[model samples]
Target: MSALRVALADDQALVRAGLRALLERLGIEIALEADDGAALLAQLADTPVDVVLSDIRMPGVDGIHALQALRARGDATPVLLLTTFDDSELLLRAAEAGAQGFLLKDAAPEDLFDAVTRVAAGETLLQPVSTDPVRARFHFRDDRAPVDSFNPREVAILRLLAGGYSNREIARSLFLAEGTVKNYVSVILDKLGTRDRTRAVLKAITLRVI
Candidate 1:
Protein backbone atom coordinates (compact mmCIF):
# COMPACT_ATOMS: atom_id res chain seq x y z
CA MET A 1 0.00 0.00 0.00
CA SER A 2 1.06 3.56 -0.57
CA ALA A 3 2.13 5.62 2.39
CA LEU A 4 -0.52 7.78 4.01
CA ARG A 5 -0.20 11.42 3.00
CA VAL A 6 -1.22 14.03 5.60
CA ALA A 7 -1.50 17.79 5.60
CA LEU A 8 -0.35 19.20 8.92
CA ALA A 9 -1.18 22.68 10.22
CA ASP A 10 -0.16 24.24 13.51
CA ASP A 11 0.80 27.71 14.70
CA GLN A 12 3.95 26.62 16.48
CA ALA A 13 6.95 25.68 14.35
CA LEU A 14 8.36 23.39 17.00
CA VAL A 15 5.10 21.50 17.37
CA ARG A 16 4.85 21.03 13.62
CA ALA A 17 8.44 19.83 13.44
CA GLY A 18 7.98 17.33 16.24
CA LEU A 19 4.82 15.91 14.69
CA ARG A 20 6.45 15.75 11.26
CA ALA A 21 9.36 13.77 12.63
CA LEU A 22 7.12 11.37 14.49
CA LEU A 23 4.83 10.76 11.52
CA GLU A 24 7.73 10.37 9.10
CA ARG A 25 9.24 7.77 11.39
CA LEU A 26 6.00 5.85 11.03
CA GLY A 27 6.33 6.00 7.20
CA ILE A 28 3.53 8.55 6.75
CA GLU A 29 4.19 11.37 4.31
CA ILE A 30 3.90 14.98 5.37
CA ALA A 31 2.35 16.08 2.11
CA LEU A 32 2.14 19.70 3.22
CA GLU A 33 2.98 21.73 6.28
CA ALA A 34 1.54 25.11 7.20
CA ASP A 35 1.99 27.41 10.16
CA ASP A 36 -1.61 28.61 10.20
CA GLY A 37 -5.09 27.86 8.92
CA ALA A 38 -4.96 30.16 5.89
CA ALA A 39 -1.74 28.62 4.68
CA LEU A 40 -3.19 25.16 5.27
CA LEU A 41 -6.22 26.01 3.16
CA ALA A 42 -4.13 27.56 0.41
CA GLN A 43 -1.83 24.55 0.27
CA LEU A 44 -4.75 22.16 0.21
CA ALA A 45 -6.29 24.00 -2.72
CA ASP A 46 -3.93 21.95 -4.90
CA THR A 47 -2.39 19.29 -2.69
CA PRO A 48 -4.37 16.12 -2.18
CA VAL A 49 -3.84 14.31 1.10
CA ASP A 50 -5.28 11.27 2.79
CA VAL A 51 -5.94 13.27 5.96
CA VAL A 52 -5.53 16.67 7.56
CA LEU A 53 -4.03 16.97 11.05
CA SER A 54 -4.43 20.52 12.33
CA ASP A 55 -4.40 22.36 15.59
CA ILE A 56 -7.82 23.68 16.62
CA ARG A 57 -6.60 27.19 17.34
CA MET A 58 -4.59 29.39 14.96
CA PRO A 59 -3.98 33.07 14.34
CA GLY A 60 -6.32 33.69 11.42
CA VAL A 61 -8.84 31.24 10.02
CA ASP A 62 -8.39 28.62 12.73
CA GLY A 63 -8.85 24.91 12.20
CA ILE A 64 -12.59 25.00 12.84
CA HIS A 65 -13.12 27.83 10.35
CA ALA A 66 -10.94 26.15 7.75
CA LEU A 67 -12.88 22.92 8.20
CA GLN A 68 -16.15 24.82 7.82
CA ALA A 69 -14.86 26.45 4.66
CA LEU A 70 -13.87 23.08 3.25
CA ARG A 71 -17.30 21.69 3.95
CA ALA A 72 -18.97 24.74 2.49
CA ARG A 73 -16.99 24.16 -0.69
CA GLY A 74 -18.13 20.53 -0.74
CA ASP A 75 -14.84 19.05 0.37
CA ALA A 76 -15.38 15.88 2.34
CA THR A 77 -11.72 15.38 3.18
CA PRO A 78 -11.31 13.93 6.65
CA VAL A 79 -9.98 16.41 9.21
CA LEU A 80 -8.57 15.66 12.67
CA LEU A 81 -8.28 18.56 15.11
CA LEU A 82 -5.51 18.66 17.71
CA THR A 83 -5.38 20.70 20.85
CA THR A 84 -3.35 21.07 24.04
CA PHE A 85 -6.43 21.79 26.13
CA ASP A 86 -9.21 19.41 27.13
CA ASP A 87 -11.91 21.99 26.46
CA SER A 88 -15.22 20.22 26.05
CA GLU A 89 -16.87 23.25 24.43
CA LEU A 90 -14.11 23.42 21.85
CA LEU A 91 -14.46 19.69 21.18
CA LEU A 92 -18.20 20.08 20.69
CA ARG A 93 -17.60 22.95 18.31
CA ALA A 94 -15.11 20.90 16.33
CA ALA A 95 -17.58 18.03 16.06
CA GLU A 96 -20.32 20.44 15.02
CA ALA A 97 -17.99 21.84 12.40
CA GLY A 98 -17.57 18.42 10.81
CA ALA A 99 -14.25 17.31 12.24
CA GLN A 100 -13.76 13.58 11.77
CA GLY A 101 -11.57 13.25 14.83
CA PHE A 102 -10.24 15.17 17.85
CA LEU A 103 -7.09 14.51 19.84
CA LEU A 104 -4.99 16.10 22.52
CA LYS A 105 -1.45 17.25 21.82
CA ASP A 106 -0.06 14.85 24.43
CA ALA A 107 -1.72 11.79 22.97
CA ALA A 108 0.52 8.78 22.59
CA PRO A 109 2.23 8.52 19.20
CA GLU A 110 0.40 5.31 18.41
CA ASP A 111 -2.95 6.83 19.33
CA LEU A 112 -2.29 9.82 17.10
CA PHE A 113 -1.31 7.62 14.19
CA ASP A 114 -4.32 5.39 14.73
CA ALA A 115 -6.65 8.41 14.78
CA VAL A 116 -5.24 9.68 11.51
CA THR A 117 -5.54 6.28 9.84
CA ARG A 118 -9.07 5.74 11.11
CA VAL A 119 -10.32 9.14 9.93
CA ALA A 120 -8.58 8.66 6.61
CA ALA A 121 -10.41 5.38 6.21
CA GLY A 122 -13.76 7.14 6.81
CA GLU A 123 -14.16 6.45 10.53
CA THR A 124 -14.91 9.13 13.14
CA LEU A 125 -12.61 9.02 16.18
CA LEU A 126 -12.66 10.87 19.52
CA GLN A 127 -10.89 8.55 21.87
CA PRO A 128 -8.73 8.82 24.99
CA VAL A 129 -10.61 12.04 25.74
CA SER A 130 -13.23 11.72 28.41
CA THR A 131 -16.78 12.64 27.38
CA ASP A 132 -17.81 13.34 30.94
CA PRO A 133 -17.17 17.04 30.62
CA VAL A 134 -19.12 17.16 27.42
CA ARG A 135 -22.07 15.50 29.04
CA ALA A 136 -21.92 17.91 31.93
CA ARG A 137 -21.87 21.00 29.75
CA PHE A 138 -24.06 19.96 26.84
CA HIS A 139 -27.78 20.52 27.07
CA PHE A 140 -30.25 18.78 24.85
CA ARG A 141 -33.23 20.52 23.29
CA ASP A 142 -36.29 21.07 25.44
CA ASP A 143 -38.19 18.53 23.40
CA ARG A 144 -35.36 15.99 23.48
CA ALA A 145 -35.39 13.64 26.43
CA PRO A 146 -32.58 11.45 27.74
CA VAL A 147 -34.97 8.61 28.20
CA ASP A 148 -34.07 6.25 25.37
CA SER A 149 -32.26 3.20 26.60
CA PHE A 150 -30.16 0.56 24.87
CA ASN A 151 -29.93 -3.11 25.67
CA PRO A 152 -26.68 -4.50 27.12
CA ARG A 153 -25.40 -5.67 23.75
CA GLU A 154 -26.32 -2.37 22.14
CA VAL A 155 -24.57 -0.51 24.94
CA ALA A 156 -21.43 -2.53 24.26
CA ILE A 157 -21.66 -1.61 20.58
CA LEU A 158 -22.20 2.04 21.53
CA ARG A 159 -19.00 1.97 23.56
CA LEU A 160 -17.11 0.63 20.56
CA LEU A 161 -18.71 3.29 18.40
CA ALA A 162 -17.51 5.96 20.84
CA GLY A 163 -14.05 4.48 20.41
CA GLY A 164 -14.39 5.04 16.65
CA TYR A 165 -14.57 1.41 15.70
CA SER A 166 -15.93 0.51 12.29
CA ASN A 167 -18.51 -2.20 11.90
CA ARG A 168 -15.98 -4.83 11.04
CA GLU A 169 -13.79 -3.98 13.99
CA ILE A 170 -16.78 -3.91 16.30
CA ALA A 171 -17.85 -7.27 14.95
CA ARG A 172 -14.46 -8.78 15.56
CA SER A 173 -14.31 -7.37 19.06
CA LEU A 174 -17.81 -8.56 19.95
CA PHE A 175 -17.62 -11.96 18.26
CA LEU A 176 -20.44 -11.11 15.89
CA ALA A 177 -20.77 -11.00 12.13
CA GLU A 178 -20.10 -7.71 10.41
CA GLY A 179 -23.70 -7.61 9.22
CA THR A 180 -24.87 -8.08 12.77
CA VAL A 181 -22.71 -5.19 13.85
CA LYS A 182 -24.16 -3.03 11.10
CA ASN A 183 -27.69 -3.80 12.23
CA TYR A 184 -26.79 -3.03 15.78
CA VAL A 185 -25.30 0.28 14.74
CA SER A 186 -28.45 1.11 12.85
CA VAL A 187 -30.52 0.43 15.91
CA ILE A 188 -28.21 2.51 18.05
CA LEU A 189 -28.52 5.45 15.69
CA ASP A 190 -32.30 5.09 15.74
CA LYS A 191 -32.30 5.00 19.49
CA LEU A 192 -30.16 8.12 19.59
CA GLY A 193 -32.42 9.84 17.00
CA THR A 194 -29.47 10.54 14.73
CA ARG A 195 -28.51 9.33 11.30
CA ASP A 196 -24.84 10.15 11.58
CA ARG A 197 -22.59 7.98 13.65
CA THR A 198 -20.61 10.90 15.06
CA ARG A 199 -23.78 12.69 16.09
CA ALA A 200 -25.14 9.50 17.57
CA VAL A 201 -22.05 9.03 19.66
CA LEU A 202 -22.18 12.64 20.76
CA LYS A 203 -25.85 12.37 21.63
CA ALA A 204 -25.19 9.17 23.54
CA ILE A 205 -22.45 10.92 25.45
CA THR A 206 -24.71 13.88 26.20
CA LEU A 207 -27.30 11.48 27.50
CA ARG A 208 -24.70 9.70 29.62
CA VAL A 209 -25.70 6.49 27.94
CA ILE A 210 -22.14 5.42 27.27
Candidate 2:
Protein backbone atom coordinates (compact mmCIF):
# COMPACT_ATOMS: atom_id res chain seq x y z
CA MET A 1 0.00 0.00 0.00
CA SER A 2 1.10 3.55 -0.60
CA ALA A 3 2.15 5.57 2.42
CA LEU A 4 -0.81 7.46 3.88
CA ARG A 5 -0.22 11.19 3.59
CA VAL A 6 -1.75 13.08 6.53
CA ALA A 7 -2.39 16.73 7.43
CA LEU A 8 -2.36 17.67 11.10
CA ALA A 9 -4.38 20.75 12.25
CA ASP A 10 -3.88 22.19 15.71
CA ASP A 11 -2.85 25.48 17.19
CA GLN A 12 -0.09 23.87 19.21
CA ALA A 13 3.17 23.82 17.27
CA LEU A 14 4.79 21.48 19.76
CA VAL A 15 1.95 18.99 19.45
CA ARG A 16 2.17 19.08 15.67
CA ALA A 17 5.93 18.58 15.77
CA GLY A 18 5.67 15.62 18.10
CA LEU A 19 2.91 14.06 16.05
CA ARG A 20 4.90 14.57 12.87
CA ALA A 21 7.84 12.70 14.37
CA LEU A 22 5.68 9.85 15.57
CA LEU A 23 3.93 9.37 12.23
CA GLU A 24 7.21 9.68 10.34
CA ARG A 25 8.72 6.85 12.34
CA LEU A 26 5.85 4.65 11.17
CA GLY A 27 6.57 5.58 7.52
CA ILE A 28 3.69 8.02 7.18
CA GLU A 29 4.17 11.30 5.31
CA ILE A 30 3.22 14.70 6.63
CA ALA A 31 1.60 16.33 3.68
CA LEU A 32 0.89 19.58 5.58
CA GLU A 33 0.21 21.13 8.94
CA ALA A 34 -2.23 23.90 9.90
CA ASP A 35 -2.97 26.05 12.95
CA ASP A 36 -6.71 26.20 12.29
CA GLY A 37 -9.57 24.94 10.13
CA ALA A 38 -9.27 27.50 7.34
CA ALA A 39 -5.58 26.77 6.85
CA LEU A 40 -6.38 23.09 6.95
CA LEU A 41 -8.87 23.49 4.14
CA ALA A 42 -6.40 25.46 2.08
CA GLN A 43 -3.77 22.78 2.62
CA LEU A 44 -6.21 20.07 1.68
CA ALA A 45 -6.97 21.84 -1.59
CA ASP A 46 -3.30 22.39 -2.31
CA THR A 47 -1.83 19.06 -1.17
CA PRO A 48 -2.64 15.39 -1.43
CA VAL A 49 -3.57 14.11 1.99
CA ASP A 50 -5.29 10.80 2.61
CA VAL A 51 -6.31 11.71 6.15
CA VAL A 52 -6.82 14.83 8.27
CA LEU A 53 -6.20 14.85 12.01
CA SER A 54 -7.84 17.95 13.52
CA ASP A 55 -8.23 19.47 16.91
CA ILE A 56 -11.82 20.13 18.01
CA ARG A 57 -10.90 23.54 19.33
CA MET A 58 -8.59 26.01 17.55
CA PRO A 59 -8.05 29.72 17.08
CA GLY A 60 -9.44 30.60 13.65
CA VAL A 61 -11.76 27.62 13.10
CA ASP A 62 -13.02 24.49 14.85
CA GLY A 63 -12.89 20.83 13.87
CA ILE A 64 -16.64 20.42 13.34
CA HIS A 65 -16.75 23.43 11.02
CA ALA A 66 -13.79 22.09 9.08
CA LEU A 67 -15.52 18.72 8.76
CA GLN A 68 -18.59 20.48 7.39
CA ALA A 69 -16.48 22.50 5.00
CA LEU A 70 -14.80 19.37 3.60
CA ARG A 71 -18.12 17.63 3.06
CA ALA A 72 -19.68 20.69 1.49
CA ARG A 73 -16.77 20.81 -0.95
CA GLY A 74 -17.38 17.13 -1.73
CA ASP A 75 -14.04 15.94 -0.41
CA ALA A 76 -14.35 12.43 0.95
CA THR A 77 -10.93 12.19 2.49
CA PRO A 78 -11.36 10.77 5.96
CA VAL A 79 -11.35 13.34 8.81
CA LEU A 80 -10.62 12.42 12.40
CA LEU A 81 -11.18 14.66 15.42
CA LEU A 82 -8.47 14.80 18.06
CA THR A 83 -10.05 16.01 21.29
CA THR A 84 -9.39 16.17 25.01
CA PHE A 85 -13.02 15.89 26.07
CA ASP A 86 -15.70 13.28 25.29
CA ASP A 87 -18.95 15.25 25.46
CA SER A 88 -21.97 13.56 23.91
CA GLU A 89 -23.14 16.77 22.25
CA LEU A 90 -19.77 17.15 20.59
CA LEU A 91 -19.88 13.51 19.56
CA LEU A 92 -23.26 14.08 17.95
CA ARG A 93 -22.02 17.15 16.13
CA ALA A 94 -18.87 15.41 14.89
CA ALA A 95 -20.86 12.49 13.56
CA GLU A 96 -23.28 14.83 11.84
CA ALA A 97 -20.47 16.88 10.34
CA GLY A 98 -18.93 13.74 8.76
CA ALA A 99 -15.97 12.96 10.96
CA GLN A 100 -14.82 9.40 10.36
CA GLY A 101 -13.40 8.91 13.83
CA PHE A 102 -12.48 10.63 17.12
CA LEU A 103 -9.32 10.18 19.18
CA LEU A 104 -8.58 11.55 22.62
CA LYS A 105 -5.76 14.07 22.81
CA ASP A 106 -4.12 11.95 25.51
CA ALA A 107 -4.33 8.70 23.54
CA ALA A 108 -1.37 6.36 23.37
CA PRO A 109 0.92 6.59 20.34
CA GLU A 110 -0.33 3.25 19.06
CA ASP A 111 -3.96 4.33 19.44
CA LEU A 112 -3.39 7.45 17.36
CA PHE A 113 -1.64 5.43 14.68
CA ASP A 114 -4.43 2.90 14.56
CA ALA A 115 -7.12 5.62 14.30
CA VAL A 116 -5.33 7.24 11.39
CA THR A 117 -5.00 3.92 9.58
CA ARG A 118 -8.59 2.82 10.16
CA VAL A 119 -10.23 6.11 9.17
CA ALA A 120 -8.09 6.43 6.06
CA ALA A 121 -9.35 3.00 5.05
CA GLY A 122 -12.98 4.26 5.33
CA GLU A 123 -13.62 2.89 8.77
CA THR A 124 -15.03 4.69 11.84
CA LEU A 125 -13.14 4.32 15.10
CA LEU A 126 -14.26 6.13 18.27
CA GLN A 127 -13.16 5.90 21.85
CA PRO A 128 -15.42 3.63 23.94
CA VAL A 129 -16.76 6.44 26.12
CA SER A 130 -17.88 8.36 23.05
CA THR A 131 -19.22 5.28 21.23
CA ASP A 132 -21.31 3.36 23.75
CA PRO A 133 -24.28 5.59 24.71
CA VAL A 134 -25.01 6.32 21.05
CA ARG A 135 -26.73 2.96 20.89
CA ALA A 136 -29.37 4.12 23.35
CA ARG A 137 -30.26 7.29 21.44
CA PHE A 138 -30.23 6.84 17.61
CA HIS A 139 -33.65 6.16 15.75
CA PHE A 140 -36.24 6.66 12.96
CA ARG A 141 -38.56 9.67 13.02
CA ASP A 142 -40.20 12.59 11.13
CA ASP A 143 -41.72 12.42 7.64
CA ARG A 144 -39.07 9.99 6.45
CA ALA A 145 -39.68 7.69 9.38
CA PRO A 146 -42.90 6.41 7.85
CA VAL A 147 -41.18 5.52 4.60
CA ASP A 148 -39.95 2.04 3.78
CA SER A 149 -36.51 2.99 5.01
CA PHE A 150 -37.96 3.01 8.50
CA ASN A 151 -41.40 1.36 8.48
CA PRO A 152 -43.31 0.36 11.58
CA ARG A 153 -41.11 -2.56 12.52
CA GLU A 154 -37.87 -0.62 12.38
CA VAL A 155 -39.39 2.31 14.24
CA ALA A 156 -40.60 0.06 17.00
CA ILE A 157 -37.18 -1.50 17.39
CA LEU A 158 -35.42 1.87 17.50
CA ARG A 159 -37.77 3.26 20.11
CA LEU A 160 -36.99 0.29 22.31
CA LEU A 161 -33.26 0.60 21.90
CA ALA A 162 -33.35 4.36 22.44
CA GLY A 163 -35.17 3.82 25.69
CA GLY A 164 -32.44 1.51 26.99
CA TYR A 165 -34.30 -1.72 26.32
CA SER A 166 -32.23 -4.80 25.65
CA ASN A 167 -32.82 -7.06 22.66
CA ARG A 168 -34.86 -9.41 24.81
CA GLU A 169 -36.97 -6.53 26.09
CA ILE A 170 -37.56 -5.26 22.61
CA ALA A 171 -38.53 -8.73 21.47
CA ARG A 172 -40.94 -9.13 24.33
CA SER A 173 -42.47 -5.71 23.65
CA LEU A 174 -42.81 -6.31 19.92
CA PHE A 175 -43.85 -9.97 20.18
CA LEU A 176 -40.89 -10.95 18.01
CA ALA A 177 -38.08 -13.40 18.65
CA GLU A 178 -34.79 -12.13 20.15
CA GLY A 179 -33.03 -13.04 16.91
CA THR A 180 -35.52 -10.95 14.99
CA VAL A 181 -34.78 -7.91 17.16
CA LYS A 182 -31.06 -8.42 16.62
CA ASN A 183 -31.62 -8.59 12.88
CA TYR A 184 -33.65 -5.38 12.92
CA VAL A 185 -30.92 -3.62 14.84
CA SER A 186 -28.44 -4.67 12.16
CA VAL A 187 -30.74 -3.27 9.51
CA ILE A 188 -31.04 -0.04 11.47
CA LEU A 189 -27.27 0.34 11.43
CA ASP A 190 -27.04 -0.10 7.66
CA LYS A 191 -29.95 2.14 6.69
CA LEU A 192 -28.79 4.99 8.92
CA GLY A 193 -25.41 5.36 7.19
CA THR A 194 -23.25 4.96 10.28
CA ARG A 195 -20.33 2.86 11.53
CA ASP A 196 -21.86 1.61 14.76
CA ARG A 197 -25.00 1.78 16.92
CA THR A 198 -24.03 5.20 18.32
CA ARG A 199 -23.18 6.69 14.98
CA ALA A 200 -26.33 5.23 13.47
CA VAL A 201 -28.50 6.93 16.09
CA LEU A 202 -26.60 10.17 15.72
CA LYS A 203 -27.24 10.01 11.97
CA ALA A 204 -30.85 9.16 12.51
CA ILE A 205 -31.16 12.07 14.90
CA THR A 206 -29.48 14.42 12.45
CA LEU A 207 -31.79 13.32 9.64
CA ARG A 208 -34.79 13.52 11.96
CA VAL A 209 -35.28 9.82 11.41
CA ILE A 210 -35.85 9.23 15.10
Model 1, C-alpha of 19: deviation from truth (Å): 1.1
Residue-by-residue lDDT tens digits, candidate 1, 1-210: 999999999999999999999999988999999998889888999999999999998999999999998888888899999976656677778888899998889989998888888899999987744687767766778324544467889989988988989999999999999999999888888877798998888778888787
What's model 1's lDDT at 162?
86
Over 72-165, each residue of candidate 2 has an lDDT whose tens digit, in order, gives 9999888988876656667667876777877888888887888788778766654433434454445444536434578878877765554435
Task: Name the regions of candidate 2 deviating beyond 4 angstroms.
Answer: 128-186, 190-210
Candidate 1 local Cα displacement, residue 161, angstroms = 0.5
- Top candidate when judged by lDDT against the true structure: 1
- For model 1, where is the 10-residue window of minimal lDDT? 141-150
Among all windows of 10 consecutive residues in model 2, the one with the lowest summed lDDT is 126-135
Question: What TM-score does structure 1 among the candidates reach?
Answer: 0.92
Best-performing candidate as measured by TM-score: 1
User: TM-score of each candidate?
Assistant: 0.92, 0.68
lDDT of 1 at 190: 80
- Tell me how many clashing residue pairs each candidate has: 0, 5
lDDT of each: 0.87, 0.76
